[model samples]
Target: MSCRTVASFISLFLATTAAVQAQTELGNFSNVARGGVATTFVTDFQAIGINPANLGRNDNARVAFTIGEVGVGVGSQALTRTQLRKFIEDSGEELNMAQKQEMARTFTSDNVLNLNVDATPVAFSVVLPMVGSFAFSSRQRVTTHLGLNKNTAELLWLGKDAPIYPANFNPATAPLVSEVLEGTSIQMAAYNEYNLAYGRQVLSLPAFVLSVGAGYRYIQGVGVVDVRSKDGQLEAYSALSPQFNVDYGSVVNNPSFNLQKDTDKLLQPVGRGHGYDVGIAAEVGKKLRLGASVTDIGQMTWEGNLLTANDQKLKRLRSNGADSYEFFSELADIFASGTDSLFQYKPAQERKASLPTKFRAGAGIRVGSRLEVGADVTMPLNDVAGNIPAAFYGVALDVKPLSWIRLSTGVTSGAGYGMGIPVGFAIATKVYELGFGTRDLRGLLSDERPYASVAMGTLRFKIGTVK
Candidate 1:
C-alpha cells in the first residue's frame, strides 16, 4: 500500500479509540431533533423519547422516521514543538520515498464527514375524551462514530526506530542492535440506545393541563483502543530477541522449555451500563408551555482487562540468576491466572449520560392568522465533574402561506461557545408530513474539525385514526 494509505489506516485506527469518548458523550443528545408535531396535541415520535407525556398528545396513530447528521470540527495545537522535531529524527532513515509522499498528502485532506446517524419512531395511541390519553412508542435512541485526525501521523514516525531486534530480523551489528517504533491509535464503535416510553395526560382543575410521562433507556456500552503497535517495528524486534533465543534453545535441549516472561501492556479498559428518564410538560394557556425532565439518573459501570504483553520477560531478564525456563514458567502462570484482576473498574456518576438533566420553558405567539413565533430556554441542572454546564436557547418562526406548506427558520445557542442557525421546511397534508432541518453553521471554526455542518430530515406517516 502507498505510504499515504498506510498513514491513513494507522491514523484511522488510532483515532478510533481516542474519539470514542467524545462520540459516546455527544451522540446521545442528538435525539432531540424529532421535536415538531402537526397538531397542538403534537405527538411526534421524537418527543416521546424526551418526555413520555408527549406521547399522550398524539391524536392519530403515527409512525415517524428521521435521518440526521451531527458533525463537529475540533482541533488542538500543543505548546511543544520539540516533540515533532524528535519524531522526524527517529523515523527519517526508515521511510521510503513513497511513504514520505503519502504522509504529506494524507495530512492535507479535510477531517470532515457527516455524522450519518438516524432515529425512527413508531407509535399507536388512543385518547378517551374525558379519561386520558395513552400511547406506546419505540425509537432508536442515538448512534455515533468519529474518524481520526491526520496530524497524528507525525507522532507515529518518532517510534519507528529502536535499538533491539526481534527473532524475525537479520541485522549487521556489534553487541546486537535492535530498533523500536511506538505509535498511538484510536478506535471507536457505533453507540446505540433503545428507548421505550409511556405517557398520560391527567385532568386536575380547569386552571391548567397536566401531563406526566416516564421512560426506560437502555444504553449499550462501547469499547475503544487508543494505541497499538505491530511486531515488525524495531522496538518489538529488540524486545523479543533475548526471550525468543532462550525459548528456542530450551525447546531443543530438554522437556522443560519454559519462558516465564511478562509482555508489555497496550490494552485499555472497556466499560458499559444503563439508565432511565422521567419528565412532565404542562400547558397553562393557549400560547404558553412549560416542561422539565430528569435523565440518566443512574450510573453505568465499566470493567475490562488492560491489554499488555512482555512485562514479565523484562522482569525475568533483570532478576539475578534468572534463565529462559524460569521466565517461560512465570509467564504461563500469569496467563493461567485469568484476566479478571487486570481490569480496573470505574463508575460513571454523571447525570443524563453527561448531557445533564434539563429544564425547559417556552412561549409561542400568533403574529397573524398565518404566522407564529416561538422561543424556548433550556437549562441544565446537574454538573458532571470537570465538564461545563450546557444551556441552550432557541427561537423559531413558522410561516404558513398555504394549508399544505410551512417554512421555518430558527437559531439555537449553547452548543459550545457559539450559536447554531437551524433552518428547515415542513410539508403536511391530511395523510402525511415531511420535515428537513440544518443547524450549527460554524464548520469553519476549526481547521482540524470533522464536519462543516449537521443536518437532518424526517418523515411522519399517519397509520390510523384514533377517536
Candidate 2:
C-alpha cells in the first residue's frame, strides 16, 4: 500500500474507533467515580450494564435521564511522554545512527497501544409504585489494542534498513515472512448497544432490603479487525463497514474475495447479536450495601464485507523507507503491501466472536450521609478481544464536604496495566447532577509513559420527587 493509503486508513481507524473500554461499565463516565466500586453504588439507568439490581433501590426521583456522557482513554508505554511529543511535533530532523539503534532496541520490547472511548447519547428510567423500575439506554463503545513483538517492531522502526536484512537482501533467499515477523497482533471492534432493564425489590426486612434485576441488550456491530502471528503461523479477519471505502485492488479477482456492493453513506451495521445481564443487590440499614452481577452473555457474528488474510511469504521491500515520525503510516505500509506480502487478503463469509463477558461483585459502607467507602473485584468470564487480561481489585472513597460538592479517589491494581489512582469531582443535587473524572490521575503527571483518561457529563436531570 502507498504511504497515502496507509495514512488514510489509520485516520479512519482512529476516528471511528472512538467507542469505549474493555470494561463495559467504565464506559458510563457519569459514574466514573464508582467505576472501580460500581456493584452497589450505581443506580438508575447508569446501572443498566453494571448491576441492574441497583435499579430496584428506590431513587430520589420518579424519573431520571442523562445525555452526552462521554469517556475516552489512550496510552502506551512504548515511548516516553517527551519522546512521543517530539515525534508528533516532527522537527524534520534526521536521526543519528546511535539514536536509530536505541530506538530500534526500544521498539523491540513488547510495546502496546490501547485506545478506548464510550459515549451515551441518552438514557431514561422511571420507578413505578408496584411495578418496580424500568430503564432504557443507548451507548456506543469502541476499543482497540495493538501489540508489537520484536521482529514487527524492528521492521516498523528501522524498516528494510535494519541490519537483520543483510547488506544485500535477496527476495529469493530471504526468510519466510512468518519466520521474520512473529508475535505481533492488532485487535479492534466498534459497535452500538441498546439496553432494556427491570429491577424490583424482592425482600424487605426492617434493616435489610434485597433486590434482583435483569437486563437485555441488543448489539449492532460496525467494524472489526483481528490479526496475529505466532509459531510461524499468521491469521487475520475483518468485517468492516462500507463507509471506510477500503480498496481491495486486483485481489477482488481472488476467489476468496467476497464483495458486496453497499452504497450507504451512513455507517451501516456489519454484524448483530444479543445478550443478557443479571444481578442481585442488598442494602443493610442504609449504611452497608452488597451486590454481584454477570454481563455480556452472548456473541457477535460478523458477515458484512468480511475479509481474511492468507499467510504469504515476504517478497521484497518496495518503498525506500518511511519517515521516522510517520509511525502509523509505516504500519500501514507493512500491513497493506498488496499480494505476496505478509498479509494477503481474501474474501470471507462470516466470523463469530464472543463479547467481553465478566463477573463483578463489590461491597460499600456509608458513614453517616457524607462519607462512603467501597471495594470491588472483577474477573473475565471469557477470553474475548475486549476482556481484561487479568482479575482487577480496587478500593475507593467518596467525601462530600458540601451539600453540592463531592470528591472521589481510589487505589486500583491488576487488569493487565499495573496500579492506578483514580480521582473525580462532582456537583450533585436532588434535581440534577454534573461530573468529571479519570480512571488514573497519576497518568497525567507521569514523565515516562503515561495513560490519559477523562470522563465527563453535563446533561443529567431528575424529575418528579418519589412519594
Candidate 3:
C-alpha cells in the first residue's frame, strides 16, 4: 500500500481501538492504593490483570481466592461529595435560579466527567510448577464520560428560553463570560470480561530470569455509548443500556433524555468479542527487575440494544427538571431523557469495537531484606470510546515489618485526574490474607483533597504453605 493509504489505515485503526480504553477496578485494593504498581511486585492471581508476566514471580502458596474486589474513581474536579450529595437530595424538587446557576457554574465546556467501576465477580489462579501459572477471572468494567460544552451548560441553567437563542438576539461581540467554545464529547461503556491466562519462565541465565506470558479474553459487551463532537457539531451512538426508550423533547434548543424500560435482559451481554494480552519480565541479579506488557488488544461487536443520536442543532431545550439526587432510578430517567431525543431511535446495527489497549513499562529494586521499591509508567495506546484517560507514572514502596504484616504507600498524578497518596497495609498468614488501602489517603488528614477514590475489599482470602 502507498504511504498515504498506510497513514489512513493507521488512523482508522486508532479510531476503532480507542473505543475500548476503560477503567481501574481490575487489581485489588492493595494495587489500587499503590499508585497502579502491578508491573513490579505483583506475585498472585492479580497479576492476570496487572502483568501476566508477573505470574512467573511464582509462589508455593498454590491457591488464591479474590472476593468482593471493588474500586471507584471520580475523575472530576468540578464538584465534591457534599455538592453531589446535595444535588441528589434535591433532584426531586424544583430548583430556584440560584441553585441552577450554582450547578451551571460547576460545569464548563472543558470540564470532564468520568465514572469508573471495576468489580471482580469471581476469580482464582494457581501455579502448576513448571507448567506455568493458570488463571481465570470475571470482571465488570464500566466507564462514563461527558465533556460539558458551554451551550450545554446554558441549556442547564438558562433553558432554551435564554435570549441568546432568540432569532433577533444576535450581539456585536461574543459574551466575554460564555464565548462559543468547542463542542464536547459524551461516551459510556459497560462490559463483562472473562480472562484466561498463562505465564512462565521463557528464558533463564546464570544471573537473570526472564518470563513471558499471554492471555485469552472473552468480552461480553453489555452496553456502549459514544457522542463525539468538534466545534459545534456532534454525532452519538449507544448500546450503554441493554434496552431503552427515549422520549425526546420537542422544545427548541432544549433537548432532554428520558430513558425507560429493561428489567428482563440487561445482564445478558448484548455484544461479544475476544482479545489477548502478552508480556515479558526479567529479574536482574535478584534485586533489580524490568518488565513490559501490552493488554486488551481485542474487539467487541455490539449488536443488541443499540441506538444512535445525531446532534439536533437544537435551538431550544428542556431545563432544570432533569438532574436529581434523592432517588437513583427516577434520576436515570431524567438523565437519559431526550438528550438524544431528536434522532430517531432505531435498532442500532451491529458494529465492531476495539478495547482500550494499554502499554506499561516498569522497574523495581530490592533494597535490603524487608524494603522494596518500584515505579511504572502506563499509557493507553489510543483514546477509548469513553473519556480519554491520562498517562500516569508513580513510585511505590512495600515494606515488611513482620512475616505476617506488609505496609505499602505511593503517590500518583497524571491523565488530568490529579494527585493521590495511597497508603495501605496487608495482614497475611499462611492460609489467609486481608488487605486494605485508599487512593485518597491524604483526604483523611486535610481539606486540600485532590481526588476522591474508594478502595476496600474484605472477602479476599488466600491459602498457602509458604511465607
Best by lDDT: 2
Off by over 4 Å in 2: 1-10, 13-25, 86-97, 109-111, 161-182, 230-234, 253-265, 310-322, 337-340, 465-467
**Candidate 2's C-alpha lDDT?**
0.73
Write down the lDDT of every candidate, Cα atoms only: 0.36, 0.73, 0.62
Q: How close is candidate 1 to the true structure, as a TM-score?
A: 0.50
List model 1 lDDT by residue over 1-467, tens digit each. 01121223223323432343122112222222212211122454445444556655424354433333222222212201232222222333344545543443343222211222333334444455555544444332221221223322322211122112234434333221111212212222223455666666775456577778776655443322222222432111000112121222222232222222334533121334455667776766545555666555554333322122231111111111102211112212212122211111111222122333445555556554567666666566653211213466777667778978876666666523235544556676656666544443332243333222333334455555444
- Give one digit per residue, the lDDT tens place, for model 2 in 413-439: 766544677888888888788888877
TM-score of each: 0.50, 0.87, 0.80
The true-structure Cα RMSD of candidate 1 reads 14.2
Residue 256 in candidate 2, Cα distance off native in Å: 5.2
Count of backbone clashes for each model?
53, 6, 30
Worst 10 residues of 3 by lDDT: 1-10
Better of 2 and 3 by TM-score: 2
Give me the runs in candidate 3 sitting further than 4 Å from their true place: 1-24, 88-94, 109-112, 162-183, 231-233, 240-266, 318-345, 386-388, 443-450, 459-467
After superposing candidate 1, which stretches have Cα over 4 Å from the reference?
1-42, 58-118, 121-190, 204-207, 224-272, 304-361, 366-369, 379-389, 441-451, 454-459, 463-467
